[model samples]
Target: DPEKLSDAIDCAPRGERFDWLLSVNINGEILSPLMWAIRDGKFALAEYVIDHLLEIRADRHAYYYGREKLFEKHPEVVTVLCSDCPALMDTLMDGLMWHSHSVNQGF
Candidate 1:
């Protein structure tokens, strides 16, 4: 299954496009492969997906909702994401502040 998932990522149409990878729509839910992996508690699979996704050059978008969920479920995944994609660290920091505000505002 992992191998198949990896192959999907490799052979996906517009595989070089971050938007395509990060904006997979499942029943109108915006989820990426990484998001699905994290949501399913597949940490090893997530690590593999993250490493592979970062290897390609493209305009990467932050799946903020998925990211927030992942951070809440496993902060270490955020650490690994930042390490693998430093550009996303800024977005993560911004989201952290936003999350803090939401909690403070009782949202």
Candidate 2:
């Protein structure tokens, strides 16, 4: 219902404006729909989620899991991420490195 929440903000009376509060309120719902769309093999929907995630710096777990799931189901999505938004690879790599360092330190 995030899209609906977005719609609500968009269609709110002229005095009401879309703000961070509204986005915060609806992010979970919005993310759910996007996740479902990706699971359903909808590349465009997955792309939409990717774009939003990049913009929001959303949860890395969700991002990684969704990307991995989509790649397993449809490898072509990897090309989209690599070619269109290579920055994501850097971000992922950085996270991996940090995690590796943390694990090594712990050990």
lDDT of 2 by residue, 42-73 (tens): 54543444443333222434322233333344
C-alpha lDDT values of all predictions:
0.53, 0.40
Model 1, span 1-107: residue lDDT tens: 56766677667545343454454778998776666665676666665554444443443652222343344444575666555655545444554434243454556
Estimate the TM-score for candidate 2. 0.27
Window of ten residues with lowest summed lDDT in model 2: 14-23
Off by over 4 Å in 2: 1-31, 56-107
How far does residue 87 in candidate 1 sit from its true spot (Å)? 20
Query: What lDDT is reached at residue 89 by model 2?
Result: 49
Backbone clashes (count) for model 2: 0
- Among these predicted structures, which one has the highest lDDT? 1
